[model samples]
Target chain A: MESFFTDSPLDHETLRRSVEDDAAGAVLVFDGTVRNHSEGHTGIVALEYEVKLPMADKLVARILEEVRTEIPVLKIAVGHRMGRVSLREPTVIIAVSAAHRDEAYRASRKIIDRIKHEAPIWKREIFADGTSEWSLGCTACK
Target chain B: MPKLVRVEIRYYAQLREDLRLSNEEIELELPATEEDILNRLAQLHPKQAALFLASRAAVEDEYLPRGTVVQDLRAVDVIPPVSGG
Candidate 1:
C-alpha cells in the first residue's frame, strides 16, 4: 500500500527487498525508463515529467481497486518521479506482492499499463539544442 | 432570456499555459450545447480554440462522445495528448 510522488532516483534493491516481506510468497517489480529517441527527434538530453497530484492520485486509486479485485495482490507499491530525469534513468516503478508468482506478474503489468494510459502526467523532452518537445502516446491528457 | 447554466472549464499541460487560464466559473445561456461552448471559447481565445480543435475533451472526468450536449455544465477537463518517456 504505497503510493508516492518522488524526485529521487528509484531504489530498485530497496523495492525488491521491501516487497519480499514475510507474508508474501512472491514479489514482482517493473521499471520504466526514459529513452533517448522519441517522436522522430534526436539529440535528446533528458525528460521532465509532471502530474496533477490530486487527479493523478484518484486515477491511481481506481487502478489499485481494479488490481485488488482482479489479482491476488497482498500489497502494492507504485512510485513516479517528477522534474528532470536523465536518459536510461528509471521514471516509474511498481512492485506487487502476492501469494503466487502469476498474480504478482499480472498485477504489475496491468497497473503499469493503466498508469501509462490513464495517468494525468506529462513529460517534456529537452534536446541538446536547448529546445524541448512533448512526448507522444499520452492518451490520458487527450 | 433563457436560464443561465454554469459550466466549469479547465485546461491541463501545455494548453493551460498557452491559454493563460486554469479554471473559470461562468454561466452560459441555457440549452447551450458543447459545441456552443466550444464556439464561444474559440471566440474568447483563438489560440486556446486552436488547441482545443487539435485536442480531445472529457466531461466530468469521462471522455464524452462527439457532439454531446452541455446542458448540465458539470466539470470539463480539456486534455491534450501528452507524452511520457
Candidate 2:
C-alpha cells in the first residue's frame, strides 16, 4: 500500500515498523530535516512555511503516481509537514518497502528529490536581526 | 484615446516579498509592452523596481521576449529565479 500524509508530524518509528512483510526483504526510510540558514539573510531566528494547499495536494498525488508507475516498489509512504517548524525539525519523511534492497533504496531517494523540486510549498526564514527571507530548501543561505 | 486590457499578475517567493503582494489585477493601455508594465510597477512599488529590473516577466505562464507584442495581456506572472530545489 502507498500512503501520503501532509498534516501530521512524520513518524519515523511508525513508518519503519509498519512497512514490513514476509515477502519483502528490505525497507528504506528517508527523513528530511530543517537546517538553519538560507539566501544571505542569516541572523538565526525562526521560519514559517506556507503552501497553496490544494495545489500541494494535487502535486503530491501526481508524484506518487509517477513513483508507483516508474519505480519497482511493493509499498511506499510519504509525508510532509506544513505550519511553523523550528530549526532541525523534521519536515518530510519517505519510506519504501520492496522485494530487494536496491528497489527500496532507489524509490526512497527519488521521492524526496522529486518533492523538493516540485512541491508548491515555500518557507520564510526570519532572522534574529529582524530581517527575513524566503527559500525553497533549508540552508539556502545565499 | 487608447484601448485598455486586463492583465493578471501573480507573484511568488522573493518576488512576492519584493512587491509586497501576492497577486493583483491591473488594467493597462493597449499596445503596452512588458517594459511599460515594468516601468509602471516600478512607480507603484519602488521597492520592487530593482528586483523587476533584474528579473524577467512571463505572459500566460510563458516567458515573453523583450519587445514582444502586448497582445491581450492576460495572466501575466512576474517571475524571478525562485525556481530552486
Candidate 3:
C-alpha cells in the first residue's frame, strides 16, 4: 500500500525525484533522524513508532496540503517510517521544490515542524539499559 | 427507548501498552459527547485514567473538538500528544 508511513526504509531518492521541477530553482531535502539520546536520556538504542492508522495518513496529507497553501512550493513529498527506527535512521523525510532557495528552505522547515507537532504519531525511546519511555513531544496535551 | 451508539475506541503508544489493548468496541447512551468516551475509558481502566482524560479525541478521520457532542460517530482514536518527526 502507498502511504506516508512505511515499515521498511524510506525512499529518499524517490521522494526527491517526485519534487523535481524545471521551474523550481532549488530542491531542499530534510530528514529528522533518531539519535542515541533524547531529552534527559542517554544510551538510546532505538525508537519505536506507532501511528493511528488510516487517520495518520489523513493527517499527513492534510499537513502537506496546508503547506502548499501557506508556501509557494512547486512540489513536495514526505515519508515517515513506522515500527522501530534505529539510531541514525531517519524517522521522517521531507523534500520540497520552489522557484528560489528561500521558499524551498522555509517550506522544508515548516513541514518538518508542523508534521511533528500535529501528526497523530508517537515514539518510544528505548535505552541501552533495556528501558523504554514515551517521548513527550509536547506538554500542552495535559 | 434510548438508542445506544456503538463506538470503537482505538488506543496508541503509552495507553495501548498500559492497557494492553489496541482497540475495543463499546456501547454508549445517546446525547454523549466525545469527551464522554474518554471518561468511559477511564472508568473501565482506572489505572490509566489520567492519560485517557488528557488525550485528544478523533472520530473517524478528523479530530473532534473537545466537548463536542458526538454525532454519527463510529470510531474514536484516543491519541496522545504527537512526537513523530
Candidate 4:
C-alpha cells in the first residue's frame, strides 16, 4: 500500500519492498520509533496513537500525490501504526524508490514531514510514572 | 423561520478527556460560527472552557476558517493540536 494506518506492528522489510521496482535504482526508507524520553522527561514507557480515520487516510494519499508531483520518483509508500506502541518499536515507516539516491532520499524525507504536519493523527506519551501527555503538533510548539 | 441546525461535534485528545466525551450532537442556530460552538461548549463545560476555546474546528472534512458560517455544517470536529509521527 502506498499509504495506510494500522494497529499491528510495522515490518520494515515489507515496507521497503513495497516500493521495490525494476525501474528504480535506489530505495530509501525512514523508520520512526518510540523513544524512551522526550523534552528532558525520562521513564517514557509507551506511545498511544489515534487517527481520525478516513480523513487521515485521505491526507496520506494527498501527501504522496503532492510529493510525486514535485519529485520524479518511481514509487513511494508510507504507513503509520495506531493504538499502543511499545518503546523502541517502529511507529511509522516511509519508503521511496527512484532512479537515483538523491531523489529517493528527498522524496522519503518529504513524505514523512508532510505526513507529520498534515495527517490528523495524535500521539500520547505514556510515562513510567503513570502520567501521559499529548505531543504538541508541529505548528504549536513553534 | 428560526435558523436552527444540528452539528455533530467530535473531540480529540486532551479536549476529549477534558470534556469527558468523544463525540456529541449539538443544536445551534444559523449563522453560528465555530467560535460560537466553542463558546457554547465552554458554557456547558466551564472547567474545560480554556481548552475548548483553544481547539480548532473542521466542518465536514475541511478546517472551518474563523468567522465561517456553520449553516450547512453536518459535523464539526473539535480538534486539539495534532501530534503524530
Q: Which candidate is the best by DockQ?
A: 3
Candidate 4 docking quality: incorrect, acceptable, medium or high: medium
- In candidate 2, stretches whose alpha carbon ends up further than 4 angstroms from where it belongs are A1-8, A38-46, A128-131, A136-142, B1-5, B27-85
Q: Could you give the fnat of all candidates in order?
A: 0.43, 0.11, 1.00, 0.74
User: Runs in model 4 with CA error above 4 Å?
Assistant: A140-142, B32-46, B65-70
Better of 2 and 3 by lDDT: 3
Superposed by TM-score, candidate 2 places the C-alpha of residue A107 at a distance from the truth, in angstroms, of 1.3
The sequence of per-residue lDDT tens digits that candidate 2 reaches over residues B1-85 is 4688777778767778766789998877767777877777667778778767655566644456788867666776665543222
Worst 10-residue lDDT window, candidate 2 chain B: B76-85
RMSD after CA superposition, every candidate = 3.8, 5.4, 2.7, 2.4
Could you tell me how far off, in angstroms, the CA of residue B49 lies in candidate 4 after the best superposition?
Answer: 4.0
Q: How accurate is candidate 4 locally (lDDT)?
A: 0.84
Query: How many collisions between residues are there in candidate 1?
Result: 1
- Per-residue lDDT over A74-103 for candidate 4, one digit per residue giving the tens place of the 0 to 100 score: 998888999999999999999899999999
RMSD of 3: 2.7
DockQ in order = 0.44, 0.19, 0.80, 0.66
lDDT of 4 by residue, B2-51 (tens): 47787777888878887779998888766777788888888878998887
What TM-score, to 2 decimals, does candidate 4 have? 0.87
Ranking by lDDT: 4, 3, 1, 2
Model 3 per-residue lDDT tens digits across residues A43-139: 9989999887788888888877887898898988888988999899888888898999999999888887877777888999988878899997856
